[model samples]
Structures are given as C-alpha cells and as structure tokens.
Target: MRRVHKALWWASWCWPGCDNQAMLVEKNVPLQSFNSFGILAKALSMLRVRSDADVDALLSNPSLKAVPKFVLGGGSNIVLTGDVKALVLKVEIMGKQLVGETAKAWIVEAGAGENWHELVRWTLESGYPGLENLALIPGTVGATPVQNIGAYGVELQDRFDSLDAIDLVSGQHFTLSAAQCAFGYRDSVFKHQSIDGEGGKPGFGLAGRALITRVRFSLPKNFKPILGYADIEKKMAQSGWNAAAGAPSAMQIFEWICEIRQAKLPDPKVIGNAGSFFKNPTVSLEQCADIIQREPKIVHYPLVDGTVKLAAGWLIDACGWKGKSIGKAGVYERQALVLVNRGDRANPVTGGEVMTLAKAIQTSVYERFGIMLEPEPVVV
Candidate 1:
C-alpha cells in the first residue's frame, strides 16, 4: 500500500467535524464485483461516496483533489482496460421520492447511486408511469443521464427534468436542466470532453469533470404508454389487447418490457456482459434506401426526422457473428448486439479480448455495409 500523505490523512479524519466519521480512502481495492462485466482489475485508491458531503470532504483535501478522479456508477456501461491508477469515486448515494406534483406532471427525484431498474419499478408502483418503456435497463440513475438511456420507444430525455452534480475541479455544486444536458441518442454532455469553439467560446461537455449526485424526472400525470415497438406489439397481440380498443396500463407495459428484455438480453449477474454493445446506427433516407435496394431484409426503423435507425443486432447477425467466439469474448447467440465473456470466474475475459472482438465486428460491419458501428460502452 502506498503511504497516505499527512494532509490526506488529516482531511479524512477531520471531515464532517466528527471523530471516527471520517471519509475512508480504500487502497488496492478489487473491482471485479463492482463492474457488471466481471473484469478483474484493481483501483489503487477508491472511495465509496454515499452522499454529497463525501465529495465535499474529498475535494477539501488538496492532495486528493489534485489527483485525477474517475466517477464510477453501476459499471454497466464501461470497459476497464486495466487496473485504474486514478482515485475512483464509487457513487453509492441512495434515495427516491416524489419531490413535487403539478397539473402537467409529477416530479420525482432519485439519488445517482440508485439502481435504475428499481427506480423505474418504484415510479410505476408509486403511480408515476412514464418510465415503463425503459424497464430492465441496466446501470445507475447517474449513468442513465450520461448515456441518455432509452428503450422500446422512449428515451431518458423524454422524462428528464434536471440533475444535480458537483464539479470535481471547482468543488462547485450545480444543477442542469434537460436542455443543458444536451441529450442525444445514447449520449449526453457527460460523455464528451470540453472543447473551445471557433471564436474562443466555451463548448459544452462535462466528462470527467462533473460527479452526478441526483437526478429529477418529470412523469406526466396523464399517463400514456409508449408502444409501437415490435416486441411490445407482439406482447400485446399475445395478450389479445388492441391499441385501438383500449391500451394496456403502465404496469402491464412495464411487465411486457421486462419480459421482452429478459428474453433478449442476458442478466449481467448470470452472464458477464453489457447490454447493447453498439448504438443502432442512424442514416439518411437516401442511404437507407440504397442499402434496402442491396439487402431487402435489413431491419430498420424510420425516425420522424426523415432518418432511418438500422438495427445493429440484425447487421451483426447478417454478418454471421452470432454464436461466434474470438478468444473468451463471444457474440451472444440470442442477441448479437450483446458481447459476452465466455470465460468463467476463474479465467474471465480480459478487456483486451472484448475490445478486440468489438474492433473486428466494427471493421466487418463497416466494410460490408459502409456503416461504422459505434460502441456504446466507455473504455476506461
């Protein structure tokens, strides 16, 4: 173990102005259990942040503040390349409640560390029903905003209200509205790095600089289920429910989504994998039309904006990658979008293997379809 500096040691003890109530800075911590991929790695220094005060306490120490920090949420959307040398702040903040209600919607707030799926379930059970389409999505609340996570027919930006975050560099607590988040398809300001514009204007990006503390959602009071996805439609047909006659309740939609996801996606606990390795690539109508002419069976959805979203899983399966393995990494047989660790706990897949397979898939897809698949997971 590395020796703790005097200032760091003192700050840990003096935080919150109480004895034995210090911020614990763990060293050489094993991270296999922390990450959903089950990749074996070690954090040279780690801190489990349970509250905003913990961040304040960590930032208060100059020695700790100067070191590079990595904010880890549920670890569902990251690929660790190797042992992390930076100080890892594992967010564990927890809480969820209805903050306010309006004629238009009900405002709900959740701690960043809260399980995203659990939060979705809570909202529905508590009578707030907007998050049903996103049921069974992995990762934490903090991570959801970062990726602008979406499923079925709804995206996070659809329900996002605002979020609280602490600036790691400035030690400033701040809040951002949905517009400020700049949510895109599986992307947000948090995924980008700061950049300077043409005229020395500041560009928007919060990656590595902001530590999300809490997130607020605005679930519409007049609940309307977002349907039309093939999976949901199939479920509705199976249950003999017609949208024209009467729509299913929010709970029903949630249950259907859960079943759909479970059938398609492997549970991270049972199988070492991340959900949806690639974003469904979007292309212009002309490009989609050209591809359609070449390959009539290509799975695609037409977006309202005159663009087409191509199903990445279908593309991978088309390329004959399904049920195939490259070392310890393999494309899932059921859903080619997911890459799994074929190795057991004793000899798990390395991040290198995952990336190698991902690169090969990207190359193959790009070469065949002229569409380069973008990986969803952040490589750390």
Candidate 2:
C-alpha cells in the first residue's frame, strides 16, 4: 500500500495519459472547515475531486483504491463523530447550464459541488423557476436527492430530471433517472447499503458505492407556484400578496422562503447547525389519532396517501428540549428540530456530544409519544 504524505503533487509529476498523476491526495487534513456543524475532526487522507477525470485518476492508483473511501459534498448534512479513516473524496465539480428544453419542461444541470441554495437562486434568475420552493436549504446539489430534501411543500424528487454518477467499486460511470433513485421522505438509494444476498433489488440501494457527478432538474414551463405551506401562507398574509390576485411569481416565493428560513433557522456560519436534526416522523392515521387523544395539542399534517406527518419539532418541544444543552451540543432556541454547536470555532462541539444529545432527545420523545424521532443528518 502506498502511504500519502501531507503535500501537493505538481502536474509534471504525474504520468502522461493516466489520471492518477493529476489526482492530488493530502493526508491528516483537518475537517472542521468542510462540515457545516463546525465539529472539529480530521481526515487521514483526502482528495479534492473536480471532475470525473479526478475519480478515474484516484482509482487508477492501486494503493488508494485498496482503502475505503468517503464521498463528501457540502458537509451540511453530516455529523463527524471522529477522524475519518477512509480516503475522503471532496466533490468540487462546477457547472450550470440549460441542457435542453421540451414542450413541457426545461432541464437545467448543475455540478455536484454547486451550493443548493445558490442553484435555486440561479434557476430563478436564469428564468427557470420550479425550484423556488426549496430555496435556502444547506448542502450541495448532489446531496439533495440523497436526502430527498423538501421544503414549502416541494421535494427534490418533484424537480429531479436525472443524475450522472460513477460506481466506486467498478469505476464505471452510469446515469440514473428519478425513478431509479427511489426517492422518499428524507430517504433514497444513497441512504441504503448494498445487500449481500438476492443480488439486491432493482433501484434499491447504492450507499457508499456511487459518486454523483452532476444533477439535472426538470423545471416545468408555464409554471404555477406551490404555496399554502403554513410559513408561506403566513408570509403572504403579512405582505398582503394574495394568491387570489394571481399566483405569486416564483421569485416572490423564493424571497419569502429565504426570509422565513432566515428567521426560523440558525445560520451555520453564525451558529453551527445541520438544518433539521430529526426527520418529521410519519405515522398511520390511527397512530396520530391515538397520540392526539393523549396530547390534544399535537401538530400534524395529512398526506395524500392517508398517512399523517407529525411535527418533530413539536414533539421535541413537547419533551421540553428546546434550547436545552448537553456540553457543547444544544437544541436551537428558535427551533427544537435543530441541534446547534454551542461551542466556538476554536473549541467546537464533538460528534460524540452531538449524538449523545440526539439519543437523549430520541429517547424522551419515544417514551412520551411511542414514536422514535429519526435523525436527519448522517452520523459519521
């Protein structure tokens, strides 16, 4: 096995025609800068992947390929528990363009490294408007489908066109349509691991095996704004922008969503946090009814499929965890669904502390409501 040192390789140092020479691998790199949670950690080895060529080059090195690898994007949705042992591939691909347009839709593609919120703003500015509902969500474009991120009544799957990725194990590039991603409520094939037996079901799981290079969104033409989300409704009423006058434009909704999120959620730059710490647990109508009988003031919404989605923040607040702290990790005062790093840049929250507080909240919520709150961020 070849050992990586803390150094940079020059272009002339690499072999001609082989990508390995171009891929620079750094060692013992500090990671507090990469993750949004501001947790201090280190990567034993890390490589910045700017393109598919970089991936190919890294794989061409037998020593690098022999070890486990971790694909990191914006680091907004992960809690680093400790130093990463795997080779870290930090995706930094960059591009944004209108790939094509049909009678019904416009397809816009972005590199995996592009900021999701910026992408939304770009789409609206570029005259493609469907992604406005999802504005201000943290993390990179590539991580969106992995989490099936949604906000203001719109989910990534609703805007997804397709994505191109490379199989880490085979080093082969492949494309997957939205259906192949199998997106669900804060879940996707990327969240699941490959099954050993049964050859795995089609469109099942691909976690840890695929590195998404680019993502394409299908923004419909002649767009209609998706409104009526409680926050959006509140904003509309406050601004006196009635949907009845005419469906508010995508730009208006985007601005409102941005304002709403800023008011509610803690800025990661100012207060380190990974958006929502828990997924809003979904339950059967019967379960919701039973909980309602006991709690009476429970917050919930009915889904199209006859299920109810409970407000995880409401559950957490009911458990009296808002603004509560365990060492350097604490729940945001404004939103119980979020967990913040109470420490400063020099001494940030540790991953262990975050998980401990998370587990405690999970236990309390489960004990009271019989529903275990599932965490939204990936615990690494």
Candidate 3:
C-alpha cells in the first residue's frame, strides 16, 4: 500500500503529465459564503491545485475549454455577486522557503494559497523585518503583488523584489519585475490587462494569461522601521513602542497594525465585507493646495510625483453615507468606506444595490473633493 501511494505522490509532482479525473474533484462543492465581504457565489468548477503539474493538467482539460478561469487565494478581497460562470482555481499549496537571504537583504517565497496574515506571522517569527506595516492585509501572497497592497504609509512596491507567474493558455511560466508590474495606485499588469476579454496587445493573444504561482519579498536584514503614517506613529506611542531605541521592531509593527485593523474593520466572518471598497484618489499638488485652502482639516498623503493621495474613507464619511443600511447590505457606521452585507438576501438587493451604493459614494466623493475615487476590485 505504501509503495503504491508513494509512487502516485511521486508521479503527481514529477510527471507533470497527469490528465486523470481521479486527482480532481468533479462538481457539487458549495463554497463557504462567509468570505470577507460575505457575498456568496457557487463555483461552476473549483479545483485546489497544489503543483505545477496539476495546473498543467487542469489547463489541458479539453472538456473545460469553453469556460473562463480565475484563481482564488484566501478569498479575502473579492465580493462574489452571484453564481460564477468561470472555473475557479483554488490554490491549496502551502510552505515557505528562503530562496535567498543575504547580509543586506532576504527573499522569501510563499505558496499562492497561503493566507496573508499567516504568512505575515511566519515572517515575524522568522525575524524578517519589512512586512510589519502591511500586517492584517487581506488576500494571499500570490494576490498581494497584483494589487501591490499597501497601508499605513508603506506600499508593496516598496518591498516587492520579484514574482513568478504561469501563463494559463500555453502553459508557459515567467518571472516579473517591479517595473513590468506597472504598479500604480492599487493597479498592476494582471488586473489592467486589456480585454478583447483576454490579453489583446494589438498583435498579442497570450498577453494576459498568467497564474501567480508564488511571490517573493525583499526585506532588509538590518532593522529599519517606517513610521510616517499618523496612526502607526500614534499607536506606537500608545503601545509605548518607540521607533528609535531598541524599540518597535518589525514584529511589533505587525502586531500594532493587526490591532489597529481589528479595531477599525469589521470581522468578515460576522459581517460580509471586502475591507475598504475604494481607492484613495490622487490629485495634483495644486488641486490639493486649493482644497486644503478651503477645508484645512483635509488629510492627504503625498505621492512620489508631486501629487497627493486623498483618503477615500474620510471623503465617503463626509458625504453622509456612513451608517446607512439597505436590506442585507449596508455601510459600516464606523467605517463609511466599507460596503457590508448585513445578512443573506431574502429578496436580496440586486447587484444593482452595490452599484447604486458605489455610484453614490463615487459621486459624493467627487463632488466634495473634486477628485473621483475608483473601485479597487474587478466588478464582474
């Protein structure tokens, strides 16, 4: 028995050629609806792939040729509206390996399937020092680089070294640099790939077929803390953690961030939410100067380019959308920016509800600040 199982396990990894039905679960799996923002959708087909070989075989399943494909990691950032039409690939792989760590820096790779918070904990325990400020971020490591997730004054591009992704169509895998990702404010090549529905770069067909296998982060071996965000600084002071003296290390920063997140964002398990639903709008420095001249309390974060990033949440709250609940969906009273589904729809509000809420928030923000806040997720 051991011989047969061992041989099969070995084959699953080494062969990369298995087109077997026995390895995959076919149909009848109901995904849990308690995703961070709690909208539920039934998967047309879902597979938890662990190996490159599995990825190859699934892509080759000729029976599924007509269906579109999407990978789900942690399900932390997405808001599933209704029944999905695509084959949802749930990556079940996990583990961590230090591909490279030098005296000056370190590189850590994690499975696309791993949880963001879990990975953050592992890094803290392992003494890595850069991801602290990014603690409590939703989604998986594989998904993180795509959004270039950022918070509390630090962005992913600040630490992103590189990543590996597999092309879904031709089964070709490739590496990407920070530059190739074209990291804008919560945007990347993967999310922004033009759609003829797929990657249509005029002459390119395989322009957008990529599966993020793993992501690597570069971190300083030496202790370097970033303390620009006011909340982080205030919390550091609150926790009696200092940035200068053998003070707030990366682990402490991670904990502080986690604490702050817990206090601010509603637990998705109890309520359905996708965290912050809108991107902070960036405006010209001149526009910012003009606005602040009127409302001196307007908070802004400066960008590398002379422009400034405005807080979308504050703007939404200012528009009086906070505490507004409609049917099963509502905006959290404390956090005006997040859209929450209070309960399952009986006569559930249509996808139109989400749209209406989005439009109202967008219009109000634009009117108040003269800057438009864009939705961060792919609304399909």
Error of 3 at 278 (Å): 0.4
lDDT of 3 at 185: 75
Tens-digit lDDT track of model 3 for 53-136: 677766665655346777777777666666666777777677777899777888988888788878888988987878888888
Better of 2 and 3 by lDDT: 2
lDDT of each: 0.91, 0.91, 0.74
In what order do the candidates fall by TM-score, top score first? Answer: 1, 2, 3
Residue ranges of candidate 3 with Cα displaced over 4 Å: 1-21, 32-34, 194-208, 242-246, 344-351
Candidate 3 displacement at residue 91 in angstroms: 1.7
Order the candidate numbers by lDDT, best to worst.
Answer: 2, 1, 3
Task: Output the worst ten-in-a-row residue range by lDDT, candidate 2.
Answer: 4-13
Clash pairs, model 2 backbone: none
Candidate 2 lDDT for residue 247: 84
For each of the candidates, the C-alpha root-mean-square deviation to the true structure, in angstroms, is: 2.9, 2.9, 5.1
Candidate 1 lDDT for residue 228? 79
Assess candidate 2 and give its TM-score to the true structure: 0.95
